[model samples]
Structure formats: C-alpha cells, structure tokens
Target: MTKSQPYTQADLAKLGNVLIYLVDRLGPISKTKALKLIYLVQEVSVKTYGLPFFNMPFLVWRLGPVAEDVFVDLSAEEPVLLANYIQRQEEDCKTFIHASQPFSDDEFSDNEMEILALVAKTYGSLSAERLVEVIHRPHSLWYQTARENGVLDYLEQGRMTTTNFEIDFGRLLDDMPERKRMYTGQLDYLEQSRALKV
Candidate 1:
C-alpha cells in the first residue's frame, strides 16, 4: 500500500477506543507507551489470527512502528476524534494520555477485544522505557525496515513487511520458548538475529 492511503474512519475510531480502553485498564500511560501497546496488539493479532488489525500500513518511524493515519489522529489538537475520549497532560516534561470518558466495546470483534485485553495484561504494566527498548530491537520489523530504508518511507517504499507477520506458532512449537523470550525483550537483538540466522 502507498504512504498516503488513509485508515478508514472506523479504523481510527477503533484505535481511539483501544487507547481509551488501555488507559482505563492500565491507568494513564504516556503517548509513546500507548502507541507501542497498539502496535504490539496489531503485531500479535497478525501473527496469531492472520488478520489485519487496522488494515492500514505502519512505518518504521524513529520512535518505532507507527501507523501514519492513527498518528495524525492522535497528535491532532483539541476537538480531534480522540479529544472526547482522551486527554493529554504534561508532567515533568513527559506527555501522558488518560481516558476522559468511558469507552464502549461495540467497535471491535470478540477476537479483537481478546487481543487488546491480552496485550494490556502482558505489557500494560511495563514502563514506557522498557517498552521502547523492546520495540526498538534491531531484529524487529521496524528496525530491519529502517536499516534498509531510512525512516518514514524515505524512498517511497511501501509499508514495512515482516516475515513474522504470519508466523505459525504451531510450526515453531519447539522454538516457542525462545521466540517468546525474544518478543518479551529477554533476548538481545544480536542474539535473536543470530538464533534465527537472519
């Protein structure tokens, strides 16, 4: 897909709802943390269910994997789509996003809601710094794409492609332990690449 392809209004609304759910469940989290949580939800959903979570492209942004249209909606000023659900606050030079209102689950499917809940349970308590470290692994899709082509589609390249996107856990049952460690930031990037022989 091209860089200019926009996420549908439904996708944007669902993302806002995801943000609201995360904040409500995990307490206030930084914008960076919220973005990473969303990315992880998409990543795991793709691998586990072989379905596109947002049906939108994400780029290897400097901060990590970022969905362009979602980024815009989240970054927009007051009166934006998320303004009604979330509020941004600055504390000690860091920006945090908190839920401004309760969010309903009407936008997501049962499986989609399950994925969001699983991700929140897994990574919601981690500090943003730890999340950043985990997501920026040199072996991650974002890092590999950014290394090949500079961040943000510098050469008009399409969305970042990941071999792990459709990985079959059943096929790798023997290696699941290692893979789990890698995803959880237990393995260093070099070690992960070496293990995978990438």
Candidate 2:
C-alpha cells in the first residue's frame, strides 16, 4: 500500500460533488442531515468494501458523527471548498443546503455510487433528529466512542460541552474477520510507508 497522502483540492472537489449528488437525490436537506448521511455512506462503504468511501474523518460529537472540515466549510460565511457546488439557504431558522450544479460521477467508482444511493434511499426520508438517534444507538461507532471518552455521560447530564473525540473506524470491522484483517493490513502498510517517508 502507498503512504496515505494529505487530502488535496481535487479530493475536496470530489467531496463537494458527493454533497451535490446527495442533495440532488434527497432534495434540500439541513446541514445536520447531510453530515449524517455522509457518515452513513462511509459506514456502508467500509462494511461492504473493507475501505472508507472518502478520506474525511468523522469525529464523535454531541450530535453524533461529524466530519469537522465539512461542517466548518458548510458553516463558513463564504465557503471555499464547496462554493461552486452547493448553496446554503436560511429558512424558518434552519439552514438547508442545495445543489448549485449537476453532480458528476467521474471521480467515483460504481461501488461508491451504489453506496451513496443506498444511504440516500435508506436514510433520506429521516429527519436530522432521527438520524442522530440512529447514530447514537448502542454499539454504533459514535455511541461507542462517546461512551469510551466519557462524552456520553457529559451529554446525559445536560452539561454543555465542547468535547469532540476521534472515532476509530477500525471498530467497524469487529464482526467481519476477513475485512478486519485486510483493513488492518492496509493500515499497517500506510503507517510503515509514512515512517519510511519521514
């Protein structure tokens, strides 16, 4: 395996296209819902293909799994990464995202497209709040990570906090031994390559 490289502008563009595709399929959706849907896409891809769909890191946040960079970009007054691909509108005190252009599948494989469609069809109709509930269910990555980091207790006590914890995607492999082995080997190769580079 090659050393893991930093996410590039091209990668961001692809991510923006993914957002556009999801919005096109699901119609205008709130930022929260969009983030959850993206997380679901990653989850499905990792389980099915033994690899992540994208390079974005999903952190365990109070609302569930959040891709921090995407969250920041979406909330920016003048978005950089997705400026040409999407637009956000404010209505009824909610921020809803819309696709500003047509989606292109040139950057994604057939399996990736299938994962995106699957996540949209399965979770598209659910509200952001409902998606949060789903992600917070027992044994879910966000739930497990939050619990391990004591963030769950903080949240349960009605305490306002700024705790964001890294979620271990490796945990997604717990039930699939073959996939787990492959995933771990991939990780090992990436780490070894990184060390050699240094």
lDDT (CA) per prediction: 0.65, 0.79
Highest TM-score, which number? Answer: 2
Question: Per-residue lDDT tens digits of candidate 2, residues 75-126?
Answer: 8766777798899988798888998889988889999888888898999999
In candidate 2, list every pair of residues with a backbone clash: none
For model 1, give the 10-residue run with minimal summed lDDT.
163-172
Cα lDDT of model 1 by residue, 18-61, tens digit: 89899889988887888789888877775566454555456556
Q: How much lDDT does candidate 2 score?
A: 0.79
